[model samples]
Target: MGIVINQSIKNTIITYIGFAIGALNTLFMYVQFLGDTYYGLVGYILSAANIMMPLMAFGVHNTLVKFYNEFETEKQKSQFLTFILFLPFILIIPFSLIGYFGYHQIASLLSKKNFIVYDYVWQIPVIALCMGYFEIFYAWVKVHLQSVFGNFIKEVFLRILITISLLAVYYNFITPIQFVFALMGIYLTMTIIMKLYALRVKMPSFQLVIPKNVKAIIWYCIFIILSGSVANLLLEIDKFMLNFYIKIENIAYYSVAIFIATVIAVPSRAMHQITYPITAKLMSENKHDDLNNLYKKTSITLQIIGGLIFIGIILNIHELYKIMPADYSEGIFVVFVIGLSKYFDLILGNNNAIIFNSKYFSAVLILGLLLIGVTISLNIVFIPKFGIKGAAFATLISITLYSLSKLLFVVFKMKLYPFTIATLKSFALLIVTFVLFYFWDFGFNPVLNIVLKSILITAFYLGLSYYLKLSSDINYIINSVFKKIRN
Candidate 1:
């Protein structure tokens, strides 16, 4: 818990800073500087790349985390690390060849509905390659329990660069087209930096020495690819599908809503950076009791924090939208729908870490494959009728169902549930605060209204959470802060 709390706090702060920069880009600079069409194009390109990222990396990122601790000796560990580093090239080479040979056909298919997407279609694979390797390197560091630097690079560095590039656009230093290319360059640069940092943490042996469990490792990586693809598809497929179903600019609209809803998941994302590797280590050591304790603690802590974010977003969303371009306001419903789904996900805490690191990971692969099918089918059916709102509905429904399935699997297979009496209490507190705050708003400027409401909501939520002792870890941290203040 010490290591988890220490790094998670740092990761959470870094992630928030990243999201703040992203908010500026998504809500203001993107709309104001790039305009909606190019914004949508950029959004589509990135989303499509994310969907392809798992396949491109061939699941090496997750494989590294799950298997890194199995070896006891430095020689074995270095062999494993060396293997993980190069394993992706097996898929990368063939994928690159396919992309090279099928460029026009691939471009044509993606841009059929919106032709602007065709020219930038090449960037999808390029960015996906960068993203795939970035995660692999990120996992390289995470397994060593050194996640802060990697988390900062993952969360903050790229967004800051994007801020600079957006400013570059604003100052007429770069065209919108150049901005698109600059994004690809940014991802590449991030990956290179991550690789260097990963090596500093533990350099992989250049000589290829296969571990005894190479067969099992390869099998795990294969299953991980399916699971990773399913997860990424669930998150990014909506934007990809929307490109075909709606006008390109509408992707920008949906992206704004998605971004707003996504802020709720930042705590989960930040905490997972540390919890994931720790969960893997616990499983490797067969420490079921510690693992379960961690499960409950992380679940409650993320729920409390994520609930506050959910409430703030839903409550202040309209006021926030008031300051944005009128066209972007239609995504308010998208915000609520996706925000609720993400909140549900957050409460599950380290459920993903538990399942992915467990032996029954193969079982989840079947469920994940089914989930991807359901997600895509729903998108095809819904996006045409309701547009971006339909995309939101599809995502909300898909994530809710998928989350329930994973929860049930864990409960049945591992006898571990993330919920407790505190969970219910925390959930009730969230509802009460939302209901109480929902109808009220200051007549001040939208930004001022948002800031005021957020402060009040934070005070109300955290005060109640502390009083109820919903999470001992959270309460302890609050008391520590109070003690420091008194001293």
Candidate 2:
């Protein structure tokens, strides 16, 4: 528990640093420097890269994490790592060539506007290749239980690069097209840096001897590819579908709101990086009781933290919109729907980690595929009607169903539920804190109002947590935090 708390605190700091950079880019630079259409194009390009990343990597990233423990020897681990590294190239190279040759036809089918998507089309493969290896190497580092550095590279370094790129765009040093290319360059460079860091830890050595479980590893990668695709689809499919149904400009607006809403999930994301490997290690040792306890604590802690972020955003959403251009302001509702989806995800705790690392992972993937089908169906039906808002609605519904399905599976199949009396108490505290902060009129100065209201809301939430005894974890965190401050 202390280790989790310590890592969580470190991750929180890194997340906030990333968030600050992200806030600057999204709220200030993006709005002021890029117009809606250009911004949306950037959004689409990134979303497309993310959508293709899993398939391009052939699930090697996840394969690394899942099978790292299976290799008992240094030579065995090296052989497996070597195979995973080269496997993605086999798929990505041909796909890139195909995309290059079929650029126009693909663009025609994807968009009505005769935009220069072709120039950027090849970047999809490049971004995918870079992002693919980044995840693989990141997982390699995680196997060593050194997640904070990887998280820093991912959450902090990437955003910092994007911020600099946005600044260049703001200064008119790069056109929109060039900016897109610059974004691709940033991803590629970041991947290189990540690789270097991983090498510093332990350079991956290629061994000629093949492991006996090669067939099993291949099957695991195949299953993981499908599972990873479904997961990415839940998050990125809406952006892709939005491109088909609406203009590129609308995507920019939707992306901003989604960004804000998704920030609530940062704690979950940060903790997951550290927790997944830990969970995997525990499961490998058949430590179900410890796993279950960790699951509950993570769920309650993340929900409490995520819920506060959700409420803070919801309460001050209007003020936030005022900072952005008028067109982007329409995405306020998208923020709410997506924020709720993230909150629900937090409440599910480490249900995903548990399922993904467990013996019944295939069953989990099958359920995920069903949910992806439902998500796609909902988006197709609703996107044309509601535009970006409808897309948000579809995402919210899909993620809600996805989280609930996982929770139920964990409870019924594994007989592991992540809820406790503390969960209920945390919910009550969240409600009371939100209601109190909701009624306060913070006046017209957006910056001051945001800061002042945030402080009060945080105080109320923590005060309520202390008073209600939400969890010993929370009480311990409070004491530790104060102790550190005092020291």
Error of 2 at 188 (Å): 0.4
Q: Candidate 1 — worst ten consecutive residues by lDDT sum?
A: 202-211
Best by lDDT: 1
Instruction: Point out where model 2 deviates above 4 Å.
Output: none
Q: Residue-wise lDDT of candidate 1 within 111-224, one digit each (tens)? A: 899988888988998999999999999988898899889878887899999989999999999999999999999999999999999999988667688878989989988988
Pull out the clashing pairs in model 2: none
How well is each residue in 1-487 modelled by candidate 2, as lDDT tens digits? 6666778788888988998888888888887887777788888888988888888889888778878898888878888888878877767778878887988888777666526455566677788878888998888888887778878888899999888888888788888678888888898888898888888887767765556887877787888788888888999999988887778888889989999998999989888877888888888899889988888888888888888898889988888887777888889999999999989988887788888888788987888899999999999999999899999999999999888888888999987879999888888777877777788966759877888888888888877877777767778888888899999
Alpha-carbon lDDT of model 2? 0.84
Those runs of model 1 whose alpha carbons end farther than 4 Å from true positions after fitting are none
**Model 2 lowest lDDT segment of ten:** 110-119
